[model samples]
Target chain A: MNDMHLCVVNITFLGKGPYTFSVGKGECVGLTGKSGIGKTQLFRAITDLIPAEGEILLDGRASASFSPTQWRSKVTMVPADSSWWYDRAGDHFPVKHKTSLLRESCMLLGLEPEVLDWQVSRLSTGERQRLALLRALQNNPTVLLLDEPSSGLDAYHTGLMEKYIGNYLRQNNPAVVWVSHDPEQLKRVASREFRMEQHRLYQIK
Target chain B: MDVIALTGVDLGLAASLLLLLSVLSVMLSLGLERKIIFFGCRMTAQLLLIGLVLRFLFASGSLLLVLLMSTIMLLAAGREVQARQKRKIIGLSGYLISVCAMFVSSFSVTVLALVVIIQVKPWYTPQYAIPLLGMLLGNTMTGIALALDRMTDQLHGRRGEVEQRLLLGQSWQEASSDIRRDCMRTGMMPIINSMAAAGLVSLPGMMTGQILGGTPPVEAVKYQILIMFLIAAGTGFGVVSAIWMSGLHLFDARHRLRLEILKSDKV
Candidate 1:
């Protein structure tokens, strides 16, 4: 673990008030909100994937100091509906890292190893969601942003993901901000929890 | 040798032949009678108007007048480009982009043709420059417009996919490489097809006109070839430039896709 910490300053985006928070290395923060409360927008703003005015710091370094590519690679997001551009699932993963625990990741999500060789269009939503997270984990991101990551998974797969993510955080020590609708799931995975009210996040647990 | 001139009565006699065709269309119930009559009237009016203005323009031969005509053509072409896009950016950005592309492409190609290729003594001679510029601008405008429109639509349509790549450490350039290539291909394809089909399926307009005006067949064919090559160059460059410049503008220094840069409307 690098003792890295993800710090966010007053991020005022999408008519949401200035948001301030910090997630330390090996720590996971759970974010819960109703539909369209600008939860995903917050993640986008933090990742600099969209336009916003604010400051985000990773390992005490301002996002401005990193190139867009470097910054995004450091702060990776696994969107609720994972996007697949290529024909086969394996094509989306970088060739150098394609086999890096690729089978293990599939197993962690209760998927077959052959899922990687399958066409993207043939994958179930749950498969796509798990693969999307595995892809992010493969990049060794400093900050992992998950937006309803387990929304498509059933209870069994979600539990598996929870176990995998917990072990991943303990091993890599990257800051994780997980957005989930299930209260029980939050209690299981998050070190701290926050609830959204009026387009802002408030610490609840 | 001078080509024979037609009297007004002679033209009317020729026009009557078109009327007979329209009458045949009506009898056949081809449903093209109104379109035939409308197109015939419009063509006559449009050609006569151009003939009158071109007579003045040719006689005056003022460089400033030629430039003014050129700017007007560019603006009209830009507006046409803006109007044709189904998913256009909102604001004057479309106009700015379309005109910028036209200026960057057609201007350079026209200058290259006049100075380097033709070496027309006065280079800016309206007699040579204006007609040549008109052809280049019109073709280049269509190509650029197609590319810009297609690229914009795709970027917006595939917003999720592109943003996802951006989130996964890809820069705007990498994220959009496929869409940009596809758009440029769409833009350049029409001209490439037209070039392939030019002489075999139908005689191109300029060649037909030259042959009708008593130029030798070989000379007309040669001129047509030159025009086709020039058009290909101008259109290819224009479409590429338009897509690249506009694509650059659509994103920020942070490599974030700036949808806000585009305005939507009927132009």
Candidate 2:
């Protein structure tokens, strides 16, 4: 767990705009902000979906040195809206181990294995979000970047997400960076948290 | 009635039938119903005007006039290609290259085959050269435009996936192979369709004309076979060259697909 250091060295948004934080390995860091405060943009930038001017270091290696694909595989992101091109869930997680992981994840999130074969187009917003979380975890990424993972979920589903994520963190000790507006959810899943306001990150006790 | 007299009247009647057929085609396929009437009208007018000019050029029997007409044909083909491809092709280079290559190859084949092989006197005669050139150039222009447009659109649409492939250690060619294959398939479809229906479903224009001009049925069939082969060859070459030339400009030095360059606001 303490074998590596995951460093987000310096990420600047819109030429000095909001919410940049660095988290170490085996730590769960939560980001909170009002809507439209550039939290999503920051997630996209970190994932290299949007261009950013800074350095991201994992195990002391600069992120720019790694190609976008390699960087993404190493540090995976589950966006707020998990849009997928393929219709089948099996298409996303093909391996048996991955399917098992997803099934377990679904059970924890109160989803059924039947949902795996269901067409993604038919999945509700909550179902898609839960499936996205499972897909992200299936990759066994070094650093997981999640943007509002439980936003669309009901209270029951939200509790399931927290339980699964909490178990995963305790068992795997992988670095998790979560973005959410809900304080209770943050208190449950996050070991440390910060608030983004007016292009700045303020540490929240 | 004399056999020769009957033959002459038959020719006139056939010409009238062709004229009527063309008008009916325009009305049915286009008319005022389709919003793309402008393209149809332009095609009709261009074909008629070219036919009139070609008639005079053939009668005059001058090499200079034939050359002038050929140049005009190339220019029109170039402009049509450019107009259809608007933003997909960034500079004038793709248009110029495609048109020039199509003109050179098709014209060369027509001249060498018609003059040297068939031994037609006044090798630069418009009667033989103009119609052949028009067919080849028209198909090539269409093929090039489709290839360029499809390639550009696919590259832009799949930018994320392409970049992901690149980051996964795929080279530029490897990353773009799928898109390139798709574009090539799109570009070659018309030629393939025409080839499929060459003899059975429709009598090609050249063959029908040759038969109307009193050439033997066997001779007309031979010319049709030769011309069809030539057109397919010309179109294939044009599509490959256009795709190759345009594809070079689509990527940056880093081998990444350039999104800004390929972006079409209109699309």
Determine the TM-score of chain B of model 2.
0.78
**What CAPRI class is candidate 2?**
incorrect
| Model 1 stretches astray by more than 4 angstroms | A1-4, A95-100, B1-46
Report the number of backbone clashes for model 2: 1
lDDT of 1: 0.86
Index of the highest-lDDT prediction: 1
Ten consecutive residues with minimal summed lDDT in candidate 2 chain B? Answer: B30-39
In angstroms, the error of model 1 at B46 is 4.2
Tens digit per residue, CA lDDT, model 2, B1-267: 222445657756755655676677677874533434455557758867867876788789898888888888788888787677536555666567667666666677777667776677777766777777877888877887788778777777776656544433355677777788788888889989988998889898889877777888899999888888878887777777777666677765445465555435374
Question: DockQ for each candidate?
Answer: 0.80, 0.12
Could you give the fnat of all candidates in order?
0.90, 0.03
Candidate 2 lDDT by residue in tens digits, A49-130 = 5566777678778877886556766677777766554568666552455566667678888988789888888899999889
